[model samples]
Target chain A: MSAQDLDGGSDAEADGSGEMPKPHTIRLELADEPGQLLAALAPISDNGGNLLSIFHERGNLTPRGHIPVEVDLECPPDRFERIVDALRDAGVNVIRAGAEHFGEEVMVILVGDTVDSDLSDTLHRIESSADATLQDLSLSAREGTDEASSARLRLAVRSGRVDETLAVVRDLAAEKGLHVVEPLAEGSQ
Target chain B: MSLRLAVLGAGAVGGSVLDLAGDYGHDVVAFADSSSSAVDPAGLDPSAVHDRKERDGVVGDADPESVFDADYDVLVEATPTTLGDAEPGFSHVERALADDRHVVLANKGPVAERYADLRALEAESEGTVQFEAAVGGAIPILSTISDLGAPHVTAARGVLNGTANFILSRMAAEGLDYEHVLAEAQDLGVAEADPTFDVDGIDAALKFVILANVLSDGETEYALDDAEVEGIRNVPGTALDLAAEDGRTVRLIGEATADGVRVAPRLIPQGSALSVTGTQNIVQLETKHAGQLNISGRGAGGPETATAVLSDVSRLE
Candidate 1:
């Protein structure tokens, strides 16, 4: 893809109009052979998909002795289907293909009785209400669940939704009597 | 350009002003410490007043109210800060302005809690209020805003509280709990015996509230109640550990914009400009054309704050 296409993707997203490019992840199983990886990737760029990343599982093999690969690419909503169809038409085993458009990562620490407040339910509510996905979470309950503990949450949110997502987290934390140490806003540093 | 001064309050800041006024070519004509006053038309000796205050808990035999009647060109309100009506501090400024005399304030109460009232009094009198010492002790935050013309400055944010910063930085560096670091800070004299105003973010919030008032330039008025303040009291050591693991550290940062003011414990990058260590303070001003200007130094202390108060007195001259 041309450099203009990549810039065009972000520009379209910035203006919040037209058919913006959406990031999608594809899981594929390729045979352990020379050019198998290159052959699988050719269909994506050929169908106007901008390659974001390629997670080549060289040592990871499927039950059938095939290498499992995960590819992240960005393209318009309509072109995404064509890219996936082209991959399948090339005789590549498409394990899964779906859109996951998280463009920003926000880190926050919630301090309180995180466990006693039903953390799973809190996480579920954040995901559904804030339109964010819980990417990673590290809980430190050294003082036991009975005492106050801190949980570091790394959330993946849509671009420009950091403030809205944080507001939701703040509301949730307030309800649970937890304190949230939010990161400085983007570009503030 | 020497000026006659009347200093109110005999606390650290007030006493420092009285001690350093002569060095700045100004004479202390009147000095008070709530209960007593020392007044002389020809100016009073700084050391004599200090000695009297040290020996007998009082500055002089004169009544505190008599300070207003002294023949001074500027009144320095260095009293302890109070919330709401801002009490005697607010009254002191009013009396100074009513006398058509300039007033320099090192008190946050009158400015943070009664900005509009102070401005109205300034408008009705020949005197003008300059409170560079009220916000960041020695950082010159308000003066910088004044120099840039408040309209050109959009926002101000920084580590405004030394006590809170000392406690947080100590906790982060030593991996100690909040209580432990706070006790250590008290021992080091970085934090006061009752640090609720600092640790609970009230002190920082008051500074940011003053900043918001300056940035608004009378278009808006911000008081302490208008700020959304959150303290570092709830920030456990594990929270700092978690932030450190991710290449970040926590600080009690206060932000003031035309929109509003908010002071809270925020996670900033470890080596960023806002991550000031110990009792140091930093103020970042976002100007309309100047990008961002950072002014950092000791945000609190007797002599450091007195310098700010003296600078205000010089401006009055």
Candidate 2:
């Protein structure tokens, strides 16, 4: 894949094809070095897939401080998922992996003393409660106190689960004194 | 999350887009031709047009407002190249933009004719109108020109169309007339039913307009009309002739100079990356520091065009 840039990666405008028979777009973050693309592609090829096209944007890194790659391949709809598991076994940071239309985007704000209050727990709760990925994040810490910090989290929630995610955000905010900016509504602004 | 896409035009290009979008498994709202653009009051599919219906297919909705009725993050435009014509499909696109949906267009007309208006609405609504497939499908030509960057993109040029190049290459190789070669292309779904844009160089010109608009910073007096577009119809006998005579192949190039840009057929030397770019699409961008960077790939079809659209989705992060 490295020798040919024919491995997985995302380029939005395309006829989604893949090495596997069933088509899915897997977003991965890998160490910026040699053979990373090859390592990712191996799992898909081994499982099921025809090498459609891979856009391993070496220049564009993912949220995990690694290159964000998108792979489009074809595979049996039933067997298409094993490739993702195989990729995980291969020790790649599978940030966001799924059939193209499965992930939903959600934005939430975390409030309260995040630094002192173990912010990792908040993130975990979101994932567990909402079945989503923390696609992007921006945090603001005022002065040196953990009591006054906030984070803007842009999440890729599983599709049709936007309500579930909003419910989780509401619950977490109520539990932790956090404030959430509801998406695109009147007061959400 | 799966994106619910409804392609309003199911031509070769639009059909390819629908096929690609459907492959994503996100609910393909519908795949209908723009001429039959409609919306269902009760959740109609976007890809339904004419008699081409399958099991569980939602027919066209009488109105196109359903595209905005529910919600869609990305709206793909793959209609024909009809710039400046107040077509219903163009109105549908405008409606999508007004509804604040991100758009990935492979359609040539709206971007070429209404770039400034579209740019204004994009800024006002914070929605993105990415036309990567519009200019050169799967070639990343828009990205290449964008790589030219602000204040740095002084000039540019390229072999923009793969379909045209393929026809010309075959004409040169087999010594066939235009009609024969074009008919073969039409049969294979490479050239459209009406191959005026590719033959007359309007397609390249429209794409050049998009490139100039996206890359340029100031209000330059650049217009698609300013382009000196000359097609393969005028070029005498194969690129092979040009290659042998000038040691280069005749390539349909969209060259943008400082304060001006033009789309014309040029002679590219043998062993050049542009020369090596076979089949449907290829792009060569001469940047300020990059100097002669070439990106070649599928320009048309479901997978390649969809790949270009997928790139736009990747950048959403």
How far in Å is the alpha carbon of B66 misplaced in model 1? 1.3
Estimate TM-scores for all models: 0.82, 0.55
Cα lDDT tens digits for candidate 1, B1-317: 98999999999999999889889999999999989999999989989999998999899999999899988999999999999999989999999999999999999999899999999999999998999999889888888888899999888999999999999998889988888888888899888899999999999999999899888888889999999999999888888888898899999999998679999999999989999999999999998998999999999999999999999888876
Write candidate 2's Cα lDDT for B93-121 as tens digits: 77777877777777777777777776777
Interface RMSD of each: 1.7, 28.0
Native-to-model Cα distance after best TM-score fit, residue B99 in candidate 2, in Å: 2.1
> What level of docking quality does candidate 2 show?
incorrect
Q: Which stretches of candidate 2 lie over 4 Å from their true place?
A: A1-189, B22-25, B35-51, B54-62, B144-148, B238-246
Write down the DockQ of candidate 2: 0.01
TM-score between model 1 and native: 0.82
Summarize candidate 1's per-residue lDDT along A125-163 as a digit string, tens digits: 676588576666777755532336788889989898999
The reply for model 1, stretches above 4 Å from the true place, is A1-98, A115-117, A143-147, A186-188
Kept native contacts, fraction for each prediction: 0.57, 0.00
